[model samples]
Target: MNNSAQKPGLRERKRRETLQRITDTGLKLFLSQGYEETTLDAIAEASGISRRTFFYYFKSKEEILLAWQSGTGAAIAAAIQEQTADKAPIDAVLDAILSLASQFDANELVAIERLLRSTEELRASKHAKYVQQEGAVFEALCAKWPQARRRDSLRLIAMASMGALRLAVDRWVEEGTKRPLAKHLRETFESLKAELGRQS
Candidate 1:
């Protein structure tokens, strides 16, 4: 089948567009005004949707904030898949994560992280997001190296990779470093490798 035949229909496209608009509007308001200060009614108005319509796309403002994080897992998964098969699994995952981190604008990331940290609920919920990312990375690794015996090792790599990423982000944010996030990610991955006695 052709790509067009596989693509979403017009109605689906419209729904996606509307959903993105709402997410973008909410993120803008949250970043500029403050997450606690932004209201559901304000997001609905800014997105050109009724409050009821907003509910059709998301149940709450927290969900909208989650939406701002939507594509990252898939991007990481894709990056892992794109790595040359000759590379070791750990190296591939490290490259994938670094690529993703490099794409993020440091200032915007700081703003978004601040907004997320502003709410106790968001901070708690964010762990679930990391878990989801680990799953994505694990699946991608398995697809690339499908030996059944490797499954356990792949799972560990996924978990450890995500743990390192979280540590890097936390330190980067706390220090307010002007350095690029990719640098932090690389350093974290190096520490991870060293802790494992340089075993890939």
Candidate 2:
């Protein structure tokens, strides 16, 4: 009912459409010409946008591949941070991962995985993003587990849990995500905790 409200909504829609066009066009060119061979100029031209506009959307060619992979871990990190004091660490970790994985579209995740594997740079970028995300999760977990008898035990748990997440992602992609990623992650983390708990 408000003209000004509708104007912002229209602009947001236009921005999404433009970004999608750039993403789609850039991805297509990367595949066709090869990831290392693709150029921003070609991508911008194909997307019917100026080079400057493409730069505004993506800082570099590798950024397009990194974009989808970067922000994904934030949800899991935040979920872990918000766990109640009474929640078991294992349950909190699994539930955080499960919450994030459930929000991803499996099919699209598969495509992002494919693109991520295309170059060492892209894979490294993905790893770097997850590393920062893991650091954040670990800090949040340390604060939550204040009564931990040994600080090293909490650190080990954080390291091992994040490692399990990486393995789950690998399995999820290799299996083409036929099953829910949340299930894969939960089972993997549960198994890791059980195995490690026995050793501790």
Q: Which stretches of candidate 1 lie over 4 Å from their true place?
A: 2-5, 198-200
lDDT of 1 by residue, 1-200 (tens): 59989999999999999998998899889888988899999999999999999999999999987777656777889999999999988899989888877787788888898887887899987888889889989999999999999999999999999899889888899989667778888899889988987564
Compute the lDDT of residue 24 as modeled in candidate 2: 72
Residue-wise C-alpha lDDT for candidate 2, range 40-108, written one tens digit per residue: 889899999999998888899888766545455566667887778687676787788787777766776
Q: Output the worst ten-in-a-row residue range by lDDT, candidate 2.
A: 66-75
**lDDT values, one for every candidate:** 0.88, 0.77
- TM-score per candidate, in order? 0.93, 0.71
lDDT of 1 at 35: 88
**Model 1: ten consecutive residues of lowest lDDT:** 65-74
Query: Listing every candidate in turn, what is its Cα RMSD in Å to the true structure after a full C-alpha superposition?
Result: 1.7, 5.6
Clashing pairs in 2: none
Best by TM-score: 1
How many steric clashes does model 1 contain? 0
Candidate 2 stretches greater than 4 Å from native:
1-39, 42-49, 56-58, 146-151
